[model samples]
Target: MTGNTLGLDKILNALFTPYKERVPDVNKITQAMVAKGLINDDSEILNDHIAFRTLGVPHLGIASFEKIFLHYGYKKKSSYVFDKKKLDAFWYEPPYSHYPRIFLSELRVSDLSKQAQNIISKYTSSIITDPVDAIDLNDYEKVGSFFYKPLWKLPSKEDYLLLLKESEYAAWVIYNRYYLNHYTISVHELPGQYSKLENFNTFLESIGITLNTSGGIVKTSKDGLLKQSSSVAKIIKAKFANDEEHMISGSYVEFAERLVLPEFKSIPKKKLTKEHRRDGFESANADKIFESTYLEQTTKNIN
Candidate 1:
């Protein structure tokens, strides 16, 4: 491992800067936490992970995106497949615990209807080569800029809506294109009143934030060790290639609480660390969380 976090930190900061601007809920939740005294400021809020969405195609998806972090010393920890959602994802463990873990998901293009696959290929086929291979992963500046770079032309509103009918995720990546999907806050690491997801979710609702009510307001793991909730994706003004514009679903914020393992419950709070907590993710929990951007969840956020 390179053990070089200084450069990795810069690369991550590059990804976060634009995302914070794109998603207002980030500041809204952080400010709410401050108001509730759960956190003194953003600095105190431990980031559990950040997620990205991609197209599962030849030149892209996890295959290409994972290279950046893998070069930075992140280790692939687990694989999660959401068959119903037609998504495959893997979460990476950071070289240093202080850094947020990475969850990269890709839509299974071939599994989609022929019409949907055609729409996706129309854009991605032009790539001809893997774009990530063209960038110097060691250059934080180039890598940072690459996230916002346009790999394909903007989809027409008609094409976007068509993909929406098949895969809302496909519609999202068609336009959003590798924008940071969501960054999570480690709820268990907060003060007592907001430590548990149940309490923190209440606090978020109290502050006028809309929670994803897909599978109840809080989605818990079968083992009951991991619980999570997410705010509905921000509705952004999207100007499409069809010369039409409309407010569309964008990135959202996520909250995760990984509970202490049964064997580690005896450890003192001050001395206990992430090592003692329930680790990785739960597919059931993640499946519902992914709906944070779906039409059902986002409709409530509108108006």
Candidate 2:
């Protein structure tokens, strides 16, 4: 049951390699921002967190997915519920201070419409047992494979649309099972201009990356402690069960800048720490951020 069989550092590197490969933009921007910040090679390019979305079916929800991180020294933290979005999620604090936090959310299957439930159940029903139970959680490579591995057959285009209409998050998991949703850069940790989401977003826009404007250029929490935005998902060609290929939104990258609370801002820079910064995700902010991958957002830029 040891999740650190390969050592946490090595395991995380192995896990993220493929994610960077699939979503090239993450690396592209991370590298650019790192240089923009004039950060030296030794310092870390802080990642606020990495997120993953899953269906709430038996064997597929956060319960199963979280074990991978739990094994790597992450402990469950705050719980967030999106009533309108029908999502239940939790954030996990990493064992290592420099490592990114983990945010995992699952669609509340029971909250979905009957038709949507039936369509999702049809594909996931075959997974009668928890697939993670079969894995040697300590085997880093094997555990990494679980994220990209497909768990069920492809859904028909009709079923995909049906699920999308009810739950954009559900439709996404049905086809893109276990793929990384988005990785957020901790803009507050960056040096100079890149340290603010507003400035960082401007730099991103200059490079021709399309930002998700659902809630605004920047989605701010009610308390104004957390500011976040994401690039609209990149469209990738996918062949549905119907044998028709269509452009579907794949994963994208997110940027977050968590500010120090008013009470802590007066503290000297040298004495400031992550604890002084705003922590945990906001449901209202995340609710709009989720639209980054919706079909409407996906096709908005298309000519």
Candidate 3:
């Protein structure tokens, strides 16, 4: 599309432009997308990030990330590399303004091997003062860290997954915020090493957890993986419940109730008006008040 097209091409160009001076060719872009299973054919137009959505489950999402790194022969921590100047800018400033940013949540790695440390230190000038501080450490003693860096120097899947498993909640928040609803999943291209849905379910059962796929919307049930099991399903479910309740009350009902009520002081007087004026109003008001109060109390209790 030559960076001039109206649709996907334009989005791709914008995403790639910051790094274009590095001038990653069509082959590099296609290879990355293919490794991530973002596209079926390498020859297909390298377009929008939404193209990533076609991949199902862990395929086009976090699972595909491992393949992307392996394809480049980059070891998790051992091959870590980034632009020191760019990283310094992010560390010293608010993350919102950083250029070519890569935001990875709860990246866990315990006892980074010497090889890994050396690789990471090469590109990032930040020194590890405390051994424990180098990796992410969650409240439950999970080892992981959230990182924001240049896209060109993002970490590998092994490192990212370790972080995710250790701090599952944080990992999910990151995935939901950045990956979910944004990327597509390609079910057919899932890695051979990945477990099947049945196997995943078995693992969940062994851990005394049950996945609720009752509604038949797989993504909500399995976090979009058809064949694989999510280690974070329980955590994701909790998040989903909280989010669903918030959306229904905050967006769906709040405005309607607000529109119906004038002020509590006005309600009693309005009810005292002539029979014609108050005909159905009192009953309607009572119902609305009951519903609104119920929702507000439920939200407060949950919060």
lDDT of each: 0.91, 0.83, 0.25
| Candidate order (lDDT) | 1, 2, 3
Cα TM-score per model: 0.98, 0.92, 0.18
Q: In candidate 3, what are the lDDT values of residues 47-90, reduced to their tens digit?
A: 11121111112112233333222222222321111221111100
Selected candidate, larger lDDT, 1 vs 2: 1
On the 0 to 100 scale, the lDDT of residue 264 in model 1 is 94
The true-versus-predicted C-alpha distance at residue 198 of model 1, in Å, is 0.6
Looking at model 1, the pairs that clash are none
Candidate 1 global Cα RMSD: 1.1
Comparing 1 and 2 on TM-score, the stronger one: 1
lDDT of 1 by residue, 213-286 (tens): 99998999999999999999978899999679977999999999999999999998888898999989999988
Lowest-sum lDDT 10-residue window in model 1: 1-10
